[model samples]
Target: MKFADYYEIMQTIARYGHALDAGTAPFDQIFTDNVELDLTHAGPPGQPGPVIKGRQHVLEAMTGSADDPHTYRSVLTRPALSHHTTNSEIVADRGDEVEVRSKFLRLGNSQPGPMPILIGQYLDTLIRTIDGWRISRREVISHGP
Candidate 1:
């Protein structure tokens, strides 16, 4: 991949963390309309994660439910949440698309300071569109049991 492609891909990944931290939805700028979000590896020790398809569904998943406000599903609604990414590897590089594997450390502010929340891996496939790189599919895998 060219330097620009690599940089842009990383930027795309960075944007995810920033968006979450800011609690903003830049859907069209970050994902494709037919995006698939697979959180099968993000559930409890052995529980199955929810697999959400379509952009609107993914948006709803991120927005989460108001009734159960403290659940992981409502993480986006929490304040002072941070996501840091590292070990971004380009798994495949096509002319117009690329696959990336990366690790993230999620932290949340506590009375003492920032506390580790979850360590996870992001498996993403991004495509170059008129607007720039947009994630078409994303699978989140948690490192914690």
Candidate 2:
């Protein structure tokens, strides 16, 4: 694969973190319309969350609950002071599609001091679309302390 293609894929990963942190980018722009999101591993033990299908549902989940004011306020304010890092490796490059395995880390000042809130690995499948590289599937596997 061309270096530019790899760079674009990296940018897409960065955009995912940026969108989550800022809540500024629309889900459709970063992910495919029929994206499959597996965040089950992020849930409690023996209680993996359901595999979310479609972009709208995924967007809603990531944006937090609108019915609860606390959840809404927390999502909007918490990540603003955080830093995100995505250490990604291109595991497969098929010209039109690419698979990346990434280590994701988030550090924020939500507690006494800046500390890690999450450490995880993302298995991402990206497709080269007319708009650019967009994530088609994402499986989040979180690391426990």
Candidates in order have lDDT scores of: 0.81, 0.75
Q: What's the lDDT for residue 17 in model 1?
A: 75
**Could you give me the TM-score of model 2 versus the true structure?**
0.84
Q: Identify the candidate with maximal TM-score.
A: 1
Tens digits of lDDT, candidate 1, 25-124: 6677778888899999987777978988877777778876323222233346477777788999999988898999999898887899989888989999
Instruction: Give the distance in Å from residue 140's predicted Cα in candidate 1 to where it truly belongs.
Output: 0.6
For model 1 the TM-score comes to 0.86
Candidate 2 lDDT over residue span 1-145, tens digit each: 8889888889888887666666464565678878999989976678797798877767667666434211233353364355365668999989899999998877767447777767888999999999889999999887852
lDDT of 2: 0.75
